[model samples]
Target: MLDGILAARPRGFSLAARYVAFALLASTLNLLVQMAVMGLYHGPWALLLAMAAGTAAGLAPKFLLDKYWIFYDRAPGRLRGLRQFILYGLLSVVTTLLFWAFEITFHWLGDGGPLRYVGAALGLGLGYWAKYHLDRHMVFGRA
Candidate 1:
């Protein structure tokens, strides 16, 4: 586990850079969805609904980009693809908890003007960092 996280391969840096870029793109889309939903809806569950919408918006692109570019996976088969997606979601549940925790904490401590987003970004960044190692070792069958 430690070595997986620490190993410095030749392509590791490049992959890391690309992964982060894609993660930012995904995050932006997620936040945009939340913002749009919040803009139109104002009910007791607005925040919850916005977050759910944002997460759904981000998942597909993130999964595709990660499976193809970040992980370099191009296996051909609908069943295999579905399996990978399921495994991805299973792993993501943990990271998503981290993200939600951070966002909710920030919301609680903030004045409701982007503090939660800052938290979400930070949380997602950390989650992605951990997730990279997990995917390398597990999802892509690296080692």
Candidate 2:
């Protein structure tokens, strides 16, 4: 579905635009998953569980979209693709820390309420921005 949309983009539609669109979609999915998880589980582990579920929900789609759309790179084989995914995960560590910092801070300050999502959104935005450059230069060899 999104692949078709990306494929049918106008000639003037820039790569940045597509990337942003994909990011927004992935972020939305992440947030939605977080909301659902938090809604379902209000136990002591609500924040932890929600964040884990949200990140898991968002990751695979983002990777596939980035691999096929943003960088337009194909994995040569199974092992190489796994290696690429692993490298991508490693590069994400720093950004993930940034996100966790914001999220945990807000969660603490706001008593684990809506403000946490605000922090998460901000963190994810910044993280995605940095992640793009990292993935471009390091993972995709497009520097």
Candidate 3:
């Protein structure tokens, strides 16, 4: 059964799907951790603290999955990997800001919990779109 499942999986789809799936799994785990931290602290600083923690945790899986599965770039030296990591860090900042913007905007527009999720989803989707293109072309060298 496992062999059949593996054999039936389309190569490109599996690559793309797994990368995205791992990213989302990592992000969810990161966010849950962050939420726990936020609840523990219960203040404005909690949000920032959660974000930092979430970003740190989220980046590692994202980098590994993208490098090995999605882009399949040749292994570069430590410095190059670090440089790429820094770029991803910057991207994460942009994504976080966008997430907050969407959340706040949606809240102001009378959105509650579920709608907040919708806003977050929209922002996250946009962030991933940009990240995929940037990783494909710039980081991995021309898709």
Give the number of the best model, judged by TM-score. 2
| lDDT (10s digit) by residue, model 2, range 22-113 | 88998899889989988899999888888878888888788877887788775578787788789988887788888878999998989977
The deviation in Å at residue 3 for candidate 3 is: 23
For each candidate, what TM-score against the reference? 0.85, 0.87, 0.74
Q: Top model by lDDT, which number? A: 2
Clashing pairs in 1: none
* lDDT of candidates 1 onward, in order: 0.80, 0.84, 0.67
Candidate 3, pairs of clashing residues: none
User: Which runs in model 2 stand beyond 4 Å of their true positions?
Assistant: 1-11
RMSD of each: 7.0, 2.4, 5.1
Q: Could you give candidate 3's per-residue lDDT for residues 1-143 as a string of tens digits?
A: 64354334336576657767866876686667666776688776665676567667777777766766667655659898888878777767776687667655664565434464466566666677777777776677754
